[model samples]
Target: IPHLLELMGFRSSAYLSHMRTLKTLEQIGAAASCRVGREDILYQFDVLREYVPVVLPLMLANVLCPSVLPEEVATAREHVLEVQQNIGENTESLLCELLHITAYRGNTL
Candidate 1:
């Protein structure tokens, strides 16, 4: 369990120390760090991915439809297109290393 926690980046003294320094810097206005949680970040990306299907329709509608969307909305849609293109161009895959529940059960680093 301790090993797993370290692998996941908690129970690691070095990481905790770094986080402490970062927090201090943020407090003194020297640096800014994210306050959002993992779930929040994941949810935002999930929402963005959900818009993939409508991207083409939205772009086509921009040409055919008579109504003009607000500038901010147009800019946001362009942002989505850029994000989608970025994702599509990427070719990296995450490493697969399953953590074990018992002591020293999985592959060691």
Candidate 2:
């Protein structure tokens, strides 16, 4: 039982890491206006956005409830928020570039 639990824990950790990487790439692509060749990246981003907040709180519940661990939660939350902010800023820049590209394309046509 203990060994099984350990294996499950490792699997969960690996899954989380993979999810985070995919999410980061999506944010970068959205921000940079660089098209992602893989559809899976976008799908993963959608899933992560839906579940990350809930999963995060559950994952840290033991450390957060009754008494808050401000430092750990704050750090994690900040990192997430920073990623979101970066994506927003990047998205705006990408939109501007896209507009310019569209205008140029229209002019050429």
Candidate 3:
């Protein structure tokens, strides 16, 4: 999926956004596979988004197949760690809040 998106000339920002969606899909699939209740799954999904810009890829890694090529989970982990370190504590908190607000807005009509 990632490779195909890249080959089709998707920009990096677009690719990252799509990757985030893929991660969400994987989580929902995992929840379903485990026979989780629909309401519980939705709640968990909402909680998962709160950790966006930080732990998203780690959560995604739990659901992704290990044999997939290009190792996007690893890349995402590295990127997140880099951002966490470079931005330090205060900026990281602010960015997380901003990401949350943006995500909330995107989810709303």
Candidate 4:
């Protein structure tokens, strides 16, 4: 179960890394990131209107056809674990997580 959670968290990083290396976002002067909510995952970007034509297809490709290479996965896994550890050590973060659990009742938030 923990492994699955880690994979879910890491996969977005892996995908983003793949896209960045391929110059999909940077070449078009766009910035992109992923967010995972309780019920949904979002892949979002900001780019100039003129650059949209160049970035949109690349973004779609990254989303529709992800290539989570082993190296990216390894790096993302390490990053996710480090972040999780940092959050664990932060009292405010722990309280926020507890608040979510209590307020959401383990349902989607």
Q: How many residue pairs clash in each candidate?
A: 0, 0, 0, 0
Candidates' C-alpha lDDT:
0.33, 0.39, 0.43, 0.62
lDDT-sorted candidate list, best first: 4, 3, 2, 1
Cα deviation of 49 in candidate 3 (Å)?
A: 34
The CA-based lDDT of model 1 is what? 0.33
Candidate 1 residue lDDT tens string, 9-108:
2111322333453353344444222223312311111124444453333323322442322543455466656654665445441111122224347534
TM-score: the better of candidates 1 and 4 = 4
TM-score of each: 0.23, 0.21, 0.23, 0.68
Best-performing candidate as measured by lDDT? 4
By summed lDDT, which 10 consecutive residues of candidate 4 come out lowest? 1-10
Predicted candidate 2 versus true structure: per-residue lDDT over 1-109, tens digit per residue: 2222222221113134424533654654422111222121111222345556544433343223322235534554666566646765687766875887677774642
Give the alpha carbon lDDT tens digit for every residue of 1-109 in model 4.
2332334432333236553534756576677666665666776778899887776766676667666567756776787777778887899978987997799895654
lDDT, residue 56, model 4: 71
> Which residue pairs in candidate 3 have backbone atoms (N, alpha carbon, C) closer than 3 angstroms, thus clashing?
none
Estimate candidate 4's alpha-carbon lDDT, on a 0 to 1 scale: 0.62
Give the better candidate number (3 or 4) by TM-score.
4
